[model samples]
Target: MKRLAAYILPVVLLACACAQQPQVSEQTTTDTSTTTPATASAAPSAYDANLAFGPDKVVELKQPESNKVIIKLMFKNGSMSDPKGKEGLTYTTAQMITESGTKDMTVSQIKDKIFPWAAGYGANVDKEVTTFTFAVHQDFLNDFYPIVRGLMLNPAFAEEDFKRVKSNQQNFVDEVIRASSDEEYSKKALEDLLFRGTNYQHMVEGKTTSVQNITLEDVKNHWRNMFTRNNLMIGIAGNYSADFLNKLKADMVQLSDAKPNIPMAGQPNKPNGVQVEIIQKDNALGSAIFTGAPMPVTRSADEFAALMVANSYLGEHRKSYGKLYDKIRTTRSMNYGDYSYIEWYDQGGSFQLPNPGVPRTANYFALWIRPVQIGEGLKQQYAELKDINVGHAHFALRLAMREVDNLIQNGMTQQDFELTRKFLRSYIKLYIQTQEKQLGFLMDSRFYGRQNYIEELDKLLANLTVQDVNNAVKKYWQTENMYITIVTDDSEAEPLKQALLNNTPSPMSYSNLVKEGLPKEVLAEDDQIANYKLNVKDVKIVDSKNTFK
Candidate 1:
């Protein structure tokens, strides 16, 4: 139905953003498959067969009436394929290929050529896959194909481009990402802890020192290994002739077929107790708290969909209806938001749905408590008055963990389960409302070794019971021991650490004018929660600038 909806409601769903179209050719063979309306009796395959260009090519097409098209060349290798010390090599290479000029055109010339056509390219680099994308009008098919084809096959690889691209990436780590946002910092730190000593440890953009060490030769070598025919899959959606598709496939096949063996990322070592890595920055007013434990399930697991249901009820990303949001944000106004994820959710704070091409074999359950004001003022009054005297991060972590503890101990209520299930059933439609997004999800379905994630999830959600969600939560979600990463002021480091060690009581602080401070029963329940002891494994504070280097 998600697939069918793209064509059915093109005006409402699709936008001007799409992909490449090729020249028509009478000699070329084209797929003549017709779009079929979805029905209960109809098998998914009855809707559309998984079309192919050749032996190695995987193509999924949606023929909407719009002139725009979305073409993606998805490579199986991503940052994980980068050689040691050459981390971010794949990402750098992708930028060099797409952003830099092609063989036939210089950087300036390529920009000039595409500027008039209003055609541009994008790249999504994940731990395991790197997808190169292009969206353009059908009228510019012949003109744009050469430019995109040139980029894929014959990149300029100029010394200037290497320096420019590499510098931009390094500066992002040093400035925007690592320096500015504690929320982002904590998330990165948790991922590092969760995937410690694995290829997945570094950011997709690579670490600062890693980017500094990467040479143009290294980028070229990494590209040669990763960007090959066997490692590639292409997706197209929009208005385009059959001959254009064939031409596009034929051009893509010109690339080499070397399939380099990418090493599988090993499971992260589980911490015995609460292990913390605090990035101490004196300028920081608040701490970004991230807590998570590695889970052994992927989308392929039977319990995955049920856990998905439970995850939504517990802390659906971005939505305010979840338990965590209700408890920490709605009732208490502790922070901007609180959310949880069963799978790796990129741009969780930004996007509602998961991005495509970022497939991870090893997954984890994570909680993100958005940055809140920490010490000294109205913010510190909550802790100071209670005699807890720790930062907001400490209290937020405790309160959020209490919710997790409750979730595991007393699972979801029947009403909550039904509400979340129904919400998800309708809410999921927005995930792939557009043709570009729908195509991305389809490609992701291929990555997870599933027939179709949406279709499978819908069926799973339909038959799922309250018992199923709770059982899955018990099996996968844990609160006893986990990794915690906090990014906060240097002043708050020791105080937060001591608070954790002392098993501090951080009860809610309300105004005096409120006749009812908190419900007596709620306050009584929180007293037990406030004293809940956290088993400390290890705690260390590192200079903020020193991190991701």
Candidate 2:
């Protein structure tokens, strides 16, 4: 059983990296009530949970062996919130919090104290949440908590510090925005276009308007809003216990419980369409084309497990569609590079997942490619996808990663092992559902939503027939299964656009359709250059074949 394997995994170690302990084998789990630490040692251990962490004051003890601890706090420092399209406000505020003067320490002194802890701590700021994370060795847990609390709770919001961080962020925006041709920017933009009209559309960098309007006070305010006792979750997994819990409580006494001031969850609207936003320039050595749209993963026939397996095949590349580009473009001389990605963000007002801001009603997949051989290159990719057949090999990763994840994350420190065990339970539930589905289908032909994702995924992989995956390909993961594309500076870009427009089997109107290679004009168009907008309608959801002459 899934639980049986997980329970026994601590009996062995997988492999070790330099300066780090061997990775514990694991499978991902759902949230669960915690169990006490095992009274005896099974085998060699990573870190003794008994020695590393203390019990949480806020949450009840459930799983004590969890490696990662999630701690939430109730603190409100609503210095500033960003205005639409006025990016970079939340970050501008965070800078004021940490780098600026604080009540207990000057900005310089604060950074110096926290330096040993945070190599790269903070990210993903928006109107809703601003985070400051500083990670240290489990041994340094008690030692570092106070320093973080001081920076977070008692900030000076100094004027001079405000001026400096804002200037630095502004410079970064100017430089990064200007370098639109870089591979990363092209990929990032492609994602933004797909998930447009949501707060997720903006990255950690808030908008320019938001940044400009942000005052020192506004920055402080956003920080203030993030900390509520109920809204916060704190998990410290290592060798720790009751004494450590008391010490943490004493240290964090300043953080009193506020009302349930958790930030509102990200609502999932039934948003559809793939919008396009392109940046054009001359002499861009290569083009970047991102194709994507919102997908229904959480509420669909394919569950997270199924989707994970399906998406893994679409990308023989690394994170965010880079692999496909290289194999097709760099390897075959198609273009510069290619990439792909599928992810779900958790938001509220829809299906609920454990992690907030995790996927609820939605999942998004992105593909990036620079075409050196446009016609053939695009054709090659779809052809490969068309023939993609999932088998034990394809889904083997689910087994491996799940186990690895379970082993690594399984423990008492994390009171919630329900998620992990739930997934495992579903593994058993897989075969049972298959049998039930057959009976229901024969009885009425009206059986629907009968496929439980986790159970079905295991059965599907364990007994995957070629026809099974091919059928899914025909039904769901086809080339015509809705997508988007953006191409940066290239002489080949326009010709490729022309080719897509004049598809022999399915011709389309290109006059106002595929945006031509051109620059963006905010106020008015310069007469000589073509001004293009990758409008929402331009989001190509590759669906049924259109009428062909």
Candidate 3:
């Protein structure tokens, strides 16, 4: 259930590129307790009992054959714990801890020492948790422990570091996302709409204004309040001595024992109909569309396994075998890719697999339609459709939703169910191919009250019947109400908005040269997809410049 395929590109490239290693093994410890079946087995019962440090603390996955050691420290608090006005405090504070130097060593000095060992560390903040991850070859564990401990226990919190981290965060929100990656911008916009008026509304980095308002003192204070022994969960993987583990535990005792009083994020506001937020940006080449609805289920739910299979059948992330991908991209060549998710998938564009350490108390079902060509690009690519300025955004959205509605109404056929389930049974095993990813997933299992997510899910998937998957779909899946976000060219915004509102017939356009290869069935289905009705309850168009402000 928990998988960390890769970090964000900027962070991975700039901060932790040296730590990258080829995954040598896919071995993970399986808990015997989870193998048993019971009526009340929805929630995993033996996660704490199997941990090395008992109930509230450490989880270890010892890979004796591995040469690298990976440590992940998760704090129970994150952006949701940010004070009312200081929205980016938790994220900025985490950045300050990982990116800045310790009190005894300068940033350059620390890097110079770590460069030889090929070790690297970084922090990731999400809605409910902030994690600091470290990786080093076991040969350097003795020497690297001090620097890692210093980063956690004694940050310099210097004015330069604070200013630099804050400026970077602000730029990420205000410029980088808006200008460089419209896919991410659309996803952020969708989350904001889904979680509007709630603690989960803002991005983990916060808005541009909120980040600017944060002072250095705000970071320090947030660290003191949220980063405590009571809130920490330690996970380590790879070869390490028992003595080293004890020393690590003793070192962590220096942290304050203050109990974290962070509140859980409330349920996101559900949409009344197809509520849409259109972000109008200048000179965009394509439209990045995201649609989602509150699912009210997490990994701990009984329906999780069933929904997983259904979501995989509809649109698996980054995979080409999904129905949506086959219909929209393979058959019609509408976009780069189309996918769906049952839980939080961070940095979907960068990571081919699900990233771990981003567990959430509240979850939603999401669809990611990677950018569709628009304007001149659309006209040039498919020159057969005359006077077609607005690209295939409308048709794509309609086709995607129509598939979901079809699944809900008719359910997956036995053959489709068998094939998808068989694929998932093998596909999930690839999630824990590395020691870092394996440790991250085991730690995440503890968060969701599970012993081992991959193990539990694999077993759950094996026993699930076609009826079970279809039943779960009928219970949870719906196309009537959703929060939709579209990032498109400024010139096409009004037309796209009008097209959605009017349920316009967006016929597929293909060049004459390419049209000769299409099947008769594909052409027949095009008519139905063009006129698919979308109950657009409301639409708001905002300039991209105004977003995250």
Candidate 4:
């Protein structure tokens, strides 16, 4: 009840204040002595567009609404079915089959076949699923699929090609990580801490550790495990042949077999004890402190909403959580702009970015403070942030989600909506509608090894309530086990470090340390977090309302 009251009180007062305000522009009444009655006004616009996601697999595909077609090809290949230790084997093989040369073709031969149509094409990897795609004229649909199939099914991972591509990816990783700026380093650091580790984490060119070890045999084995008919999901949306569909189906259905394991549902819970690790660079501008806890791998609708409410208090909402910026940075101003967020991840978390100079990491969830503050009042700064009124934070959550639902639904162009539906089609069918398979570990650990979570999530989202939001806060947010992380300049950070070490701490002096530690480069940049200061808004004073925990 108290949780509900905290959020409700501010709104009630705001409602009353609005009632007293002038609504003259929205109304027109003339001269003295004559009374005019007011007519009804239109209701405010509040739409939840996802309410249209619907329950069909074909996706209520809205036609070209225009003539040009959007081509989607499942472009399957023969990879991932073989062995484990040899990872890069199939990737290397693709260079020969699709990059240029195939059965009746040279590099030039492949392009010559399609050049007359002035079409477009591309390719990508998914561990178990890789694809080559093209967008060409509708008239050439029959001609295009045949060429794509020859390229996809016959990929040649030649030795010379493997050496060159592997070298390029390694160089890309080296350059990005080694050259990251101070900000970039901090960003990556956040990612590292967020996910706890990078095992289930996605990596573009793997890590420095894995990249160095990859062999051509690895690519081939990786391809062997993935390339097979049993694992294919093909979607082609354009003007094409119905009779050809049966023929196309016949050509690809012959091959099916077992494959190497794609890592399954394994999500790491928050680390039990509070600990901190620092990444050091000789001249780093400053450090970032990351505060976080494990969040559910997938949240209920209420918890998802409360993620907004919790985040508002933890980091981003300047108007509500702005006090965090003020108490930690502004009172003295060390934060160029520190951000707190429950970073998104459908399964575990992703890898740190390729930038070396910024803070990037994969910690599951975190509130990140950049640079360090050299201060004595460390305890007070931490305590005040917790002293916040979470009810006020709930207001910010409502506003953010209200806008997200509105934007996705009403603001989407028909073309984008169709594409979104298509992108989500497989996901919805496999995870929501059909429910036998879920993405990897999400099924095993979370669903009791059964498919219960599919219905659980649906029912939870369907009957989602405000009370659920309140309960999540009572269970997660208000818990005494909350952890803290603060990143700041190490040398200048000594004061806060000492203060944390010493019980006696000064408030004003500590605030100034947060300011002095910032790099001159960051100070020069007029960033929002850097200059943030707090002056609480003046709302009408109401009778005291106590919210006991």
Q: Candidate 3: list runs displaced more than 4 Å.
A: 1-53, 380-383
lDDT of 3 by residue, 48-95 (tens): 222223344677776676677788889999888888877878888888
lDDT over C-alpha atoms for residue 514 of model 2:
21
What TM-score would every model get versus the actual structure?
0.87, 0.54, 0.90, 0.50
Give the CA lDDT, 0 to 100, for residue 326 in model 3: 92
Clashes found in each candidate (C-alpha, N, C closer than 3 A): 5, 102, 5, 75
Against the reference, the lDDT scores of all candidates come to 0.73, 0.37, 0.81, 0.36
Name the candidate, 1 or 4, with the larger TM-score value. Answer: 1
lDDT (Cα, tens digit) per residue for candidate 4, span 1-549: 000100011111111111121111100112122222111132111111111111110111112221222222222332222123323334444443455444555545657766776554544443233443345566666676666556555545556656666665555445544344444434444344434333323232344444567776665554445554434433333334444433443444332243335444224345444333333333334444444555552342335444443344334522323334644455435455544455432111122211000111222444545445332223346543332211111122122222223332344334433333333223323331100112111212121322233344444444534344445544443211223333333333333333332322122222345447766654443233322221111111111110000
Consecutive 10-residue window with the lowest summed lDDT within model 3: 1-10
Model 4 weakest lDDT span, ten residues long: 1-10
Q: Give stretches of model 2 more than 4 Å off.
A: 1-87, 114-131, 138-142, 246-277, 298-302, 316-327, 335-337, 344-361, 370-487, 490-499, 504-549
lDDT of 4 at 398: 20
By lDDT, the best candidate is 3
- Residue-level lDDT of model 2, residues 408-485, one tens digit each, is 233212212223233334433322222111221111111123222333545545554334433443333322223344
Query: Which digits, one per residue and each the tens of the lDDT, describe model 1 over residues 1-549?
Result: 000100122232346344333211122234443433223243323113222243224555556556667788888887888888878788888877865787778867866776666666667788888887777777887888888788888888989988888778878767777666778779988888878788988888888888888889887877777787557777777777666766676666556645688888767668888888888886787788988898999988778989888889877788898888987787767688899888788766556776666777878889999886555433445433444356566667777887887888898999999999999888876676666666777777778877467777888899999999999888888877799988988777888777776777755444444316556766676667677777766788878888777
Best by TM-score: 3
